[model samples]
Target chain A: MTKQNTKKLSLAPIPYFWDRDYTHQFYQQVAQSPIDIVYLGEVVCSKRRALSLQDWMTIGHDLQAAGKQVVLSTLSLVEAASELSVMTKICQQGDFMVEANDMSAVQLRTKFESNAFIAGSSLNIYNQRSLDKLKSLGLSRWVLPHEHNQQALHAFDLGNVELELPAWGRLSLAYSARCFTARTHNRSKDQCGFVCDQYPDGLAMKTQEQKDFLVINGIQTQSGTIQNHLEAINDDAVDILRITPQQNNCFEVIALFDQVRKQQLSVTDGQKQLTECTVHPISNGYWHQKAGKDWVA
Target chain B: MELVCPAGNLPSLKVAVKAGADAVYMGLQNATNARHFAGLNFTEKQMTQGIEFAQSRGCKVFLAVNTYPYCHDLPTWQQAVDTAAELKVDALILADMGVMDYACEKHPDLNIHLSVQGSATSAAAVNFFAEQFNIKRAVIPRVLSIKQVAHLVNNSLVPIEVFGFGSLCVMVEGRCLLSSYATGLGPNNHGACSPAEFVEWKNTDSHLETRLNGILIDQVAKDESVGYPVICKGRYQVNDQIGYAIEEPTSLNTLSILAELKAIGVAAVKVEGRQRSPAYVRQVTEVMRAAIDDCLTRPDKYVVKDSWNQTLGDLSEGQQTTLGAYYRNWQ
Candidate 1:
């Protein structure tokens, strides 16, 4: 059911590898936006060295100074020992609340006895008992997996845990050890030359019919069509609406969402404005229990 | 190291046991298991008979109720756990956290093996499951190189099991949603990927087209053979070129690395594909069994025979094989 007013807006970390100056400018815009929480980190390939952990911490501090709650997100796939070590440092940094993207991150947080952390969508918590199990291990909130539907959310008996939903940006569909961005260039992942920086958003993939199919950013694959859930911002089941960072017009998208959530704009008008913000097609099919590429309306 | 094999039906189970599989893993005829195919998997009666047949042959039986259950479907998964415990299978392979919690509480004595669908790629992730659910063994995803695999084996709190042969999952198992993005059903939630009902193959004047839920996945010349329409294996266009942008159709064959896996202290080597025929299971089990036995017998003199490699390659998808991510070069 649609509640008249939504609670909060969160900015998901930049899933791409952008230039340092470009990333700083993006955050400068985010600092002045109406985002309530800001997640900052290199959640995708750890090889993308455009930003270091200290760099993210600086951005976090700046966003915090701007009166936005900040979260440090760990990597979604931890395959290398070096990657695991990085995750351990994030879990133990003890500066900001951590978002555990993988079970390895969750284990380290529980072992270090961090008071409470956010469960990233990739944690694979599909049921209430699973959430409860993590709750016992110090979980305060969780971002629902993008594939989950409204019916699945209703089934979860979330006692006091807050729920966050992805409301905008390209959906991260899958991750692999093999980097597609490198493979597209016929280069191995180790010798990738950090070419992912060329596509600040992500490299688009199309079907044989030239239909938009997917986006490749190093090891992560995302939906070619951006997901716009502006209509669902008023969902009472959601405590926060997540807006992933894009290469352009992100704040305008955030402002439109902010207006919609505050009941300052109609859903129809908000969606119409959202279409002008990105060249990609928009989808809300996952929220309607259909294929993720479809738009219900 | 142990040689674990897949069995989709009672006949396949018997074939695997007779072919020298140390243990045979089978799934129930429901969405509780990953291979939720139309005509694949075991009914309750078939499961009881299969378990009895395997046990009588001195081969252990593992019940795989490995799919994640939605909260509304908790009772169905809980019932599966109860049935597995009552039947007294040697161990249960599970992926869902809630199902694992239920099995741990209801049948504390039952052994649990973390399924690859659990997506535990590191020591910390496996240890977390071991501490929380008391899982005796964990299967790592196929995304790790041999060096990384050795590192995890060295650090994991419990014994680790790695896939020996299978249709490789290019993406991490449990975290992937590409199939659902196209067809609205996936391995994690629906126990299937590129489900058969959504697949359609069309023959044209010049080429054969493969589609999943009406989206073109791959089109091959009339002379070229087309395998299943898994999204990762399909060709797509990126930039100016059209090719296998994700992955080519190939099966993972670790026959060359059998000795290395044993040397790394891996507990078992699992052969994937529960949807294969009994003939495929028989040949794969025989080859894997002999390979493991040879490796254990004389680690210094172990060499993969050309005939064994030829036999496995013939049975692979697309009649091709790859080292997959086990070798760093593949990554």
Candidate 2:
């Protein structure tokens, strides 16, 4: 086992909406976890008002007190003036690092502070040149988009900026203006009624053959299969492993990853534990440069 | 407002120009451009000919070098930009920041239009491109409503271009990875969505099944009309109901809202079909040109003619046309 103390585990901000109390409870549990970093705030639809800025700040303070790095994430798609306003406020918070999910957020961050920020996965950084360009714009760390293969990562000289890879959870495939969860219930986006809360992880979508395909979480669509790269935790390219928060066993998954990273458990044992905890099939094909749905194991 | 039409080849470019397109956008026959399909787009000689033909008719030619380049392939994208500049194309439509930076530094005088794939929905995002790369125009993503478009146009430092017609992408461009998830090819990395090679058509006893890289996208009866198995447009079992869960397979037709678009100070209207035939380009370009002309001539008298609607409807995907995200109801 590689004794690398640099490997850190981060909790990705919840992409779906849970009740405010549930979110608070989740973070309270996270505050006691072995996770190194916690990303707070919403990255999906703005309609999800489970937590306000003050709520997130309070949570951030708690995580900070718990000896964890807190990075506030901005929205993935900034279409409205209201969303842009929120993004600007988030970027100018100045207390914590901001994850610029959209270009607007990146622009706003660069405008407010020359200090480094994390470029979220939605900001398409396909190559080393693009990465270098973003680095020039004050990007300190970046999450690799789930679509990029490991071969692509190996080819790039990522420089000083830390590389964070999604180590667990469903891949956020796409986001749209229309709330798909609303559409599923034959309701308009304006009248979505926060139905995404019903499926805390996300609403599962299947093919005609009853094969699990996608999960619709309001406007965001994710893979039905949870991406588990616990076995590949020792990759030198990765500095941080991001585990997305889910409704169930999210903390256990984080603990398993932490144990694996610390050499307390074998990769196979970690995978077995993760499989036992997750309801969906596990996949690592995106890391293997194959179809995302394919499970190499 | 100007009408920007797409040209997959030299013939399509000529048809666009002759059919009244103010500008025709195309790409090189490589992954540097978004429409990097087999036997589509242009060669160097073909691009030169396309520019000459468009210029002869007092129309403009824009080269689309819009795809993101990996570190190993950065030189190819830079070369494409350099070649397009050398060819004296009217403009270069680009998406990636690195490529935009290269274009700005290497070819300072070349006009750069931010591609729709850049996903610049907000004015701040548009201004960022304009301020950094001196982008002259920006193609807005198809995710914004007309009200949102108006807000952006009001605040934008650069001129705004909107998708007036063609197939609608339910997700914001540059952000979508659904294609990549399903077929290992996407607009950002591979420059192709639902790549032709991954597409398979199977005819069962009762239905015609379309699959992309072995994931069943849609299955339809023999008599039912079928569209391409673009993952977003596919039917799926959502909430125990089977239908187009994401978006129905329909082409965007903003002809009805031409007057409103003009009033909102939109600099140009873009037609989004490069993989389409010259005939498709000609019909769409002609109808849009006529509609824009009529709308400009008399805004009060402007109305989407049934004939124009029928012409576009004939060429629409799935034999259906929609206002898409431009209409708030569609969202």
Candidate 3:
């Protein structure tokens, strides 16, 4: 494998519903971190109005001024026309790079900007041909889908676009029209009382055997375990490591990944530090092409 | 609106055609299609015969080459497309953008319909696919409400088709990774979710347990009726409650809202089971065809007949039918 010091660290957009103050405070800590890129915006639910576009832009400016590249991420599921309009506005901002999570976002970004955009992992890019097709539409970098295994990556001709992989945090598993968080509280989606804020890390779902299975965050369902690939940070395929924001010490998590990627700390020590910060167990089975919830290591 | 039915094999295709289906959709006996189950789908000779039989009876046959292919296996999907085009099927239902690009450039004359696995929920997404590949129609995912379906139909550049009667997928198609999280196989990568090989059934003294790859999916008393062990439909615990957290084991039956769907200008109604038997196809196709014809003929006097309901219920998963996301309350 080719070797270089090109590995960078990226902060994935917040997938949970954090209150305004908590959101601000989280970014305040992120600004002082050694992360290379900061992706800001609400990518999960449209009802999550804790941070508006202007609010995210203000934070983006702050992160940019702090020597971090800011990328605004669009919603993964674009259902309403209003959401499409918001996406259009974000794509046309021209101030920051936009991560196209859905195809509508990609179309809007391609229509507005000539420069390549970052294709988010939600785009379902499974093959080289799909990658080549996206490249024609001006894809600058592509995030591998969380389900993609090491063998799948080896076979894919990533071409010239940079590859980003999720290194830590809950793996987003499924999305539906029904708000699971609302359903959990026996409320309709239209009348949902923004109860997702009650569980900043998301409501845990367990199997019948009481095994922690999944987490419900509004309409998005995520893995119950944190997916950490810190040991694979030096893998040549990954150009960037994405650390998703969580409720706890995400700054420390980012620092741990940074140290491990820079080879300042051994992977074993980094994994131990990561385990201490996570609320649940850590899984790396996805990297080994096994069930995503399994810990192959 | 036209009625689109699924036919897993030649017998199913013949059954659907005999039952007055407007079109019968099937796939090759390979992993290129989404319903890549054992002892199902059609061979090349059977596909040619099925096409001839359907065309002779003024019915169309669509080939579903809908599964996403990775780099190493893309040639298999491309070969399926070439075979479908050479067999002179009515249309190719595709989901992958790469495969769509291939079909668009390789066989310009072949018709293309966006598969439900494409997950185009909004007008902008549909228009993007239409503009890029010139898809003739796009199937809407089962996640939209009836009002949303109407809005999409009014705004879509191409005609839209929605699921009418079949197994309901609670999660949006093309986006779910729950199966892969459990069994290491999923719709996008493996074309099947909660594959049969991973399923295990055990009977204890008091209850019957269903597991998927050693993960407990559901457990029911011995006297209770059992449903298919699909991962999403299984009972699970969320908060203090334990039940069908994701979705219940019910089939999506939109028969009661046929008039509303027809009024919204929905182009076609798609059935979901390609892994089902020929008997299931015949019964569902006949009932849906009768219902659609009756609704179209007398919209003012249309009523969902009890007989039709019984027929569908007898074949439905868990013996229950719901409007699914067509009604907001079901959401």
Clash pairs (backbone) in predicted model 1: none
Compared with the true structure, the alpha-carbon lDDT of candidate 1 equals 0.91
lDDT of 2 by residue, B182-278 (tens): 8777888788999999999989899999999998999999878677889999999977889889988899999999999999999999999999999
Task: Spell out the clash pairs found in candidate 3.
Answer: none
Sort all candidates by DockQ, best to worst.
Answer: 1, 2, 3
Which lDDT tens digits does candidate 2 get at residues A1-297?
363456999999998888898888888899899899899998998988878888898899988988999999999888899999989889888789999988898889888744578999888888877888889889999899887778889998877888899989989988888889988888888888888888887888898777899999988999988998875577889889999988778888988988888788888888898899987888888888888878887
Off by over 4 Å in 1: A1-6
lDDT of each: 0.91, 0.89, 0.89
TM-score of 1: 0.99
Output the better candidate (1/2) by lDDT.
1
Candidate 3 has an fnat equal to: 0.66
lDDT for each residue of candidate 3 in A1-297, tens digit (9 for 90 to 100): 225356899999999999999889889988889899999898989988988999999999999999999999999988777888899899889889889988888778778645579999889787888888889889989988888888888887776888899988899888888888888888877888898889898998999899988899999999988998887677888889998988777888988887776678888998888888776988988889899989986
User: Candidate 2: misplaced stretches above 4 Å?
Assistant: A1-3
Q: Model 3, residue A162: what's the lDDT?
A: 89
Model 3 chain A weakest 10-residue run by lDDT:
A1-10
